[model samples]
Target: MHTIFEPMKPIPFSPPRIDEKTIEAVTEVLRSGWITTGPKTRELEKKIQQYIGGGPVLCLNAWTNAVELMLRWMEVGPGDEVIIPAYTYAATANIIIHIGAKPVMIDCEPNGFLMDLNKAEAAINENTKVIMPVDFSGLPVDYAAVMEMAKRHAGIYKPRGENQSKLNRIMVISDAAHSFGALYDNTPVGREVDVAAFSFHAVKNFTTAEGGALVFNLPAPFDNEAIWKDINRKALHGQTKDALSKTQAGQWQYDIVEAGYKCNMTDLQAALGWVEMDRYAQDHLPRRKSIVARYNQAFQSCSWAILPKMQDDIVESSYHLYALRIQGFNEDDRNALITHLAEMGISTNVHFQPLPRLSFYKNMGFQESDFPRAFEQFSNEISLPIYFDLTDEQVDCITSAIKDYMQSR
Candidate 1:
């Protein structure tokens, strides 16, 4: 007979896959004298570039900081608008607010977590400087569609700074925090957009304790390497050389080119990322894929289940979140399921509550009713746990709990 699972030892929602390997790498970094933003950070950037085969990658302190710096580099400020989806984390809009730019929020498609491209196109005007599409739950947005939209709107595009003048159109910056290893058009997600910002927070599939990165792939007439250098300098207080380079003989003398933000990644964080990147493609991602598959198998036959969009011909998700929706289930039903699971030693979460529902955005005159689809998607959505360390048995247990709850109801 099988023993009953107990709530005393509850399953975590999304824990970092910290093993002996991660411990060893971090220990080595601690032992080294030079610990902050050193060789390991640079090495991790290179590894990320190689893995994605995109433009130069720059690792920074957080996704919010990296993308905010990108906006500052583009000189987006008052009277400029950056279009974004309504269904996403607060950080997506917070970064825009930090730059004094308006975040023109658009509603998601009906029964979808991603923004409606048709509505997005209609929402564009001359003040629109950037279009930051989020890859919700590791599933990449239609980046090519966004690029085409930008090109179509080039005639009405307004240029603020040198960087904006060079592009001569709305910039497409992807909020790919959950899609580090995902693919769009059979290539990595970072390649299609002008810039892709990824999060390496503790709960992500690829973790570095607390960090993020940017992959630059701007079109011609814009030198990516120079932009990378400029961003590197900007991330380090606009200093001519980083701490690692300043250590070299006769390199002590450096000048501050601009008053830049301090958001560079440290060696300790980079070391953890390095260890993750070393086995990411070969080991970590495959395991996530397996868990997603198991969840899919369990829910496919259920009439009430609306499975997440994991993969298709054009795109493949990184499987960051298994946001499963239930048909005919209201918000109360979803919360009930979560509470029931918690009582049975399982943990589940909701991906988001939609930005308009939040007090800050709502106070900004953004009514939740305006984005009906976003509210519809958020009301019934449930994000199940999917991580590298989640075992097959645990997957079954979690699925069984959900099935039991639904069937009983």
Candidate 2:
């Protein structure tokens, strides 16, 4: 009863590829006497800034807190509204709540996962402080359009504090969790947005085990180094001196500047980042791109196969997730197909379920009907296996399995 093409091994969704070089780097950090937030963390910040073409970079413990740090720096709080796409992960909106700011959930693009700029424009009002754009599926949003929209509505934007008044415009805190190396019109994600937050979680294209970063790309009058110092202070219990600095002979005494949250990145995590960043542009990205290219090549001719975007001249993805959409497949049938694939040893996943549809948002009076397009994206979408170690033959197997599943239906 079994076919000759049956899967020989289990396929995981996404796994970090840690080679011996990465292991040795982490081991070196372990051997180093200072294991806390110290030299390695600072080095990672510098390397990230260099990689991003000179912007303020803060290495943190999670992507969520990284965004919160920017919001806190912006002084976003009660009565302020932050616009977020309903199609992204929850943390994108949760940080808004953490800062006592309201989250205005908006529908995604009519046929895509990114935020709909037209809808976002209409949603902005006097209370709108930030527009958090997510780079869903590793494809960067239209940065120029987003800025132009913000500029158009600049007259209505009200500044609550010194930083807000100094900037005098709505901040675009791009939630670029899925897009580390993604580019929009020759500009990196971090460079294109006001402040972009990135995740280095295990499942992402690049991993630091459990780490994140915040990058600044603001204009003149905003001192990048001064802001970096403020963020550094904010992340470490507002301590004037860090542990490394305290280790110095006469620098032991310090003061707590303000009540700050603790989410500083450690030397162990930064060690992983140093290795991964070195490999990303040269090895990891290309390998992931090849896997996606193979998937696209196999599925392009099929009528039901709605392909994911790999790149255009204007937008280049980090090749993070292979979000494949199947035409005419409803939610029920999509779930069925997922079960079928799992039975065959091929793992599949849904990119998102749209925030408004979740129970928490529903209890807050937000409806799934408000975000029809997000539901449409969630219904038929299936993210394929897309890690660096996936093989060409396995890619063929995945495509063949999908074709067979479609045929069965």
Whole-model Cα lDDT of every candidate shown, in order: 0.91, 0.88
lDDT of 2 by residue, 8-43 (tens): 698888989888989999899898877789989898
Off by over 4 Å in 2: 1-3
Question: In lDDT terms, how accurate is model 1?
Answer: 0.91
What's the TM for model 2?
Answer: 0.97
lDDT, candidate 1, 230-259, per-residue tens: 998999999999988888998899999999
TM-score of each: 0.97, 0.97
Q: Tell me each candidate's RMSD, in Å, in order.
A: 1.6, 1.5
